[model samples]
Target: IARIAWLSMGLPLEVAATTVDSQCGSSQQATSLGAAMVASGMEDVVMCCGVEMMTRVPLGSNMKDGVPMGESYMQHYQPTSQFMGAAMIAEEYQITRADVDAFGLKSQQNAIRAWEENRFEREIVPIEAPVLDDKGQPTGETRVIARDEGLRATTLESLAKLEPVPGQSIHTAGTSSQVSDGASVVI
Candidate 1:
């Protein structure tokens, strides 16, 4: 997929194949590592890519036993800290439902506009999936998927109506980032 993506984007082969992982900052770390490699005379050029198919892979599946080990460690090491998404973000930034909803709305609007402008075409490779009928028989044609699946036509009214997810006091599907499948590359 990376190879195809790079080729489609007209990027050079020297700017390919490198990988990095830094939890949520994998792409940033990839850029830093690439820059360091070039500065240290390791390579002439490097391509850093980050692809998180969060929708396909359940959260915590990559971690050992799907456990919140980091939370446990923090609880054991620092009793005062509560390690969870909503609590952490809310405590850190005093984030409210309004703030989160506003951010989500902005994100959705930007994504929609980008899609409309065809700004993503240069990097997106339309993937074809077999078309199936109601009974699951292949219709002999393919359906192209070119857009990000995370986007939804949303409104503040709809957002305001959503209840927070279980165990989260300030987060809902409307106010939190969507589970998405996409890849990105930097040269």
Candidate 2:
């Protein structure tokens, strides 16, 4: 994917291109490596980019073939999902669901305000994203994606009503990691 992205952008073919897979921290790892290369005088410039189409490939899909949780891991965690881990952390910290809702509400409010204030205009790189059909195939067309489409209007009351993922004590859809699909490049 890294090589394809580089070639698609018409970058120099001789330049090294590689993919980094650190699970959730892949982007950060890639960015840090790129920065390190530049800082070490090994490269004058670097572009760190990543893409995740969750709709096309849902989370935990790769584990279907077999991603066994090691015994070492079970010794610390309950051998449950990350959502359960989040709930355990919440319990240990005494972070109430109300507290989570308040934080989520504030975040949504701030993001909505930022969009209204045009704070992201300068940083946004408009892209032509494909319009997928019901079967998930591209419709041979595209749509302009110029802003963050993830923002939602939410109130503390609304957020508080969301239930945690089944078997978890906290971390609801409103408070947990949200699904997103997109690619970003940082230079």
- Write down the TM-score of every candidate: 0.68, 0.80
Candidate 2, residue 99: CA error in Å? 1.7
Q: Tens-digit lDDT track for model 1 on 2-51? A: 57776788877765564455555777777888889899998887778777
Worst 10 residues of 2 by lDDT: 58-67
Which runs in model 2 stand beyond 4 Å of their true positions?
59-80, 139-141
Global lDDT scores for all candidate models: 0.72, 0.80
User: Clashes per prediction?
Assistant: 0, 0
lDDT of 2: 0.80
Pairing residues by index, what is the TM-score of model 2? Answer: 0.80
Per-residue lDDT tens digits for candidate 2, residues 27-106, read 78899999999999999989898777666543554344543666788788666667777778889999988888888888
